[model samples]
Target: MSNSVKTINPATGKVIREFETISDQQLQDKIEKTHEAFLDWKQRSFDERGALIRKVGDLLVENQDRLSKLITEEMGKPINQAPGELQLCQGICHYSADNAASFLADEERDLPGGRALVSHQPIGVIFGIQPWNFPFYQVIRYTIANLMAGNTVLLKHAPNVWGCAEALEDIFREAGMPENVFNVLYIQEDQASQVTEHKRVRGVTFTGSAATGRKIAAAAGEHLKKTVLELGSNDAFLVLEDADIDKAVDACVTGRINNNGQTCVAAKRFVVVDAVYEQFRDAYLAKMKQVEFGDPSDENTQLGPIAREDLRDNLHAQVKESIEKGATCLTGGEVPDREGYFYPVTVLENVTPGMPAYDGELFGPVASLIRAKDEADAIRIANDSVYGLGGGIFSEDEKRAERLARDHFDTGMVSINGYYIAQPNLPFGGVKDSGYGREHGGFGMREFVNSKSLMIAQ
Candidate 1:
């Protein structure tokens, strides 16, 4: 229970900066101010809101270099990939600003005796608890949509990315957003719990682990408040009997190691049919072994250190436990003898249900390879996990792959013949243990809004 938030550079394992947490009284004042701002904000026209939101996107473009560097320094995302995260954030803001009006406009419907109108209206202040994995994108994912929906926002970002949070607040300010329309909370866990209960806070949105998402859902449920949770995933990538082995290997390698494999939707499991298992495994392992790990800022570094020492330790522990439980390590399971919190790109074979590598998220540069009897078994293995966030299918038969992805993937989203990340126009989120609700597309703009029905008789 420290009184201040300290950020560390995972590349050097050194403290970057420290900022003091706000007092309880300050927290209360900020909440009140945000709610007050929401009252006026919700009354403004969508065009007005959209104009301001578009400015936020413009600011992101203007400051991409500085902000991307900040992201790499704070969270250990490779410098090359950090800009891509901001690029996604920029798209989110622009998309929300452009489409939210049409998405939230009133709709005319036929009623028993007359016409009915359904209008989506903003509630009030929405509180978001986001992770550090994609600092800018995570915040923008929720914030822009809520703002476009006319609700003021309060963010309790991960402590390790407090600097990113503050930078966002500053960006909103510079974009001429009214005071207190978007606020960042520098508070402890206990304080966050209290904020969730505040009467002014109408809804909650969280992105993190399933265990923590449950706690958030429970806390919000006690008050009968609305919530949207986007939790973790051990996503699977399938290789069918007629799949393109080289194509699958290239995509799978990038899918697992991108962001140094810290992505929640990153492909963790490779389920290959017996026909292609050996080929896929051999090529996948060879490429994974060649991933260059170094300082995040280095242009040639393909893999950077984990976000923190403890996360690296936890990832290594999972690898060890999986090895002890009968999984075979093919490459890069050892922590490197380096200065930073570096773990090499690892590949594990023969992963089964009882092992951590099979059942849980590694959250680092580790890949799990599972052999399947055939395409049916591969599909079964992919759906076997409690998480259903996102998964992939690789096959030469596009029609068959599409059929499986559309009908049997059992996840919020699926990729056909390759891998993909979050898209501003597509829905994101998961089911079962991966948490509930959807973001991006038009769904996020309506997640926290009220749809009121009006009956009219002529």
Candidate 2:
């Protein structure tokens, strides 16, 4: 096996840096140190931890420009959008730091024979297996919560975003956080699997595809360890008959292309009511075609190259397979003759059940248009999927849309008529094949903790 990992600049398809993967002994030492740190960390008051976490957030803001440029260089994120990711991370850190004490406070409950106090106690080290899509945010999303909960964390980030991982560790150190509290392990998959079975690793949290999530969950389960998996989704964006066509089109376009359409909850499948199918399709296609795919460093570039050459190739393969299966390529289906791993914004109509565009996530700047007979049919179509991380219902009637999202949408989250990547105060996670457990909105602070009940006889 190779002893190192290389990070390539997706925008130029050139190698940026190569990092040496740590040996088994080094990995063990890091894990042991982290567990040692957790012992003292869990004893600290919430205020103490929060103060340090807040400092980390400040550091993120202070270094946003430099870090944002690194993200663009490593993963091909558009220059305009990269800063937004860092801002979200900053928000996550401060949000968790602010609310963790209240969220995890001991609760009093009345019992017939005794009074009960339910306390959330910190577990040991948590192992995080994160992806490259939102390198900084993905790590912060879980790390901050775990840190606030008094548990040290070990991150096995995607190879492509290892640079971001190291930078985050540096930030935490600069913030005066404990040396072993936030560790970035530079190891391969087999080593990661071994770490899952390590005696020190108390829990595991992963974000990636459903297939990989299943494997991780199974591995963690065999050891009787807790696991939180936030897997992929081909989220359906419903366009009801009463939807505001212009607004829905614009939102869907942004949703499908944001993060270059590699997002788990991005608007992948467009289930539009047949009443306004032609109108939405025409307008969406025109706007998608206008999106510029070029250098990620360019301010005017609306889209950027796919994160890796293999990812770009896989996305193109899915497009071709969907087209072969009778899905009509409406626009931007061909790969451009560019130097980087660039794929044009694509739209596919007549996307039926059997096609890749309909069944699987296209994980790129691609959209699938599925027509429905009416509002009921649109809802039905949206729910016809094994993965239900999130979905959107666009309707002019705000109350009706909220009602549909609340009672009818079979997903973990829903957007009434707009696109939102994530919010600091909202619980973010999905259901069904999209994985289980929740993050953010204070739920993440408890995922790796022990909820113990203390009873006192009256």
lDDT of 1 by residue, 1-458 (tens): 67987999999989999999999999999999999999899999888998998899889878988998898899888888887888788889889988998999999999987899999999999999999999999999999999999999999999999999999999999999999999999998789988999999999999999999999999999999999999999999999999989999999999999998999999999999999899889889888888978989886789999998999999999999999999999988998887889999999999999898999999999999999999899999999999999999999999999999998888999988788999999999998899899999999999999999999986
C-alpha RMSD of each candidate structure in angstroms: 0.8, 0.8
- lDDT against the true structure, each candidate: 0.93, 0.92
Which 10-residue span in candidate 1 carries the lowest summed lDDT? 81-90
Residue 305, model 1: lDDT of: 90
Error of 2 at 344 (Å): 0.2
Taking all chains together, each candidate's TM-score versus the true structure is 0.99, 0.99
What would the per-residue lDDT of candidate 2 be over residues 247-341, giving only the tens digit for each residue?
Answer: 99999999999988889989999999989999999989988889979888988888999999999999999999999999998888888887899
TM-score computed on alpha carbons, candidate 2: 0.99
Model 1 TM-score relative to the real fold: 0.99
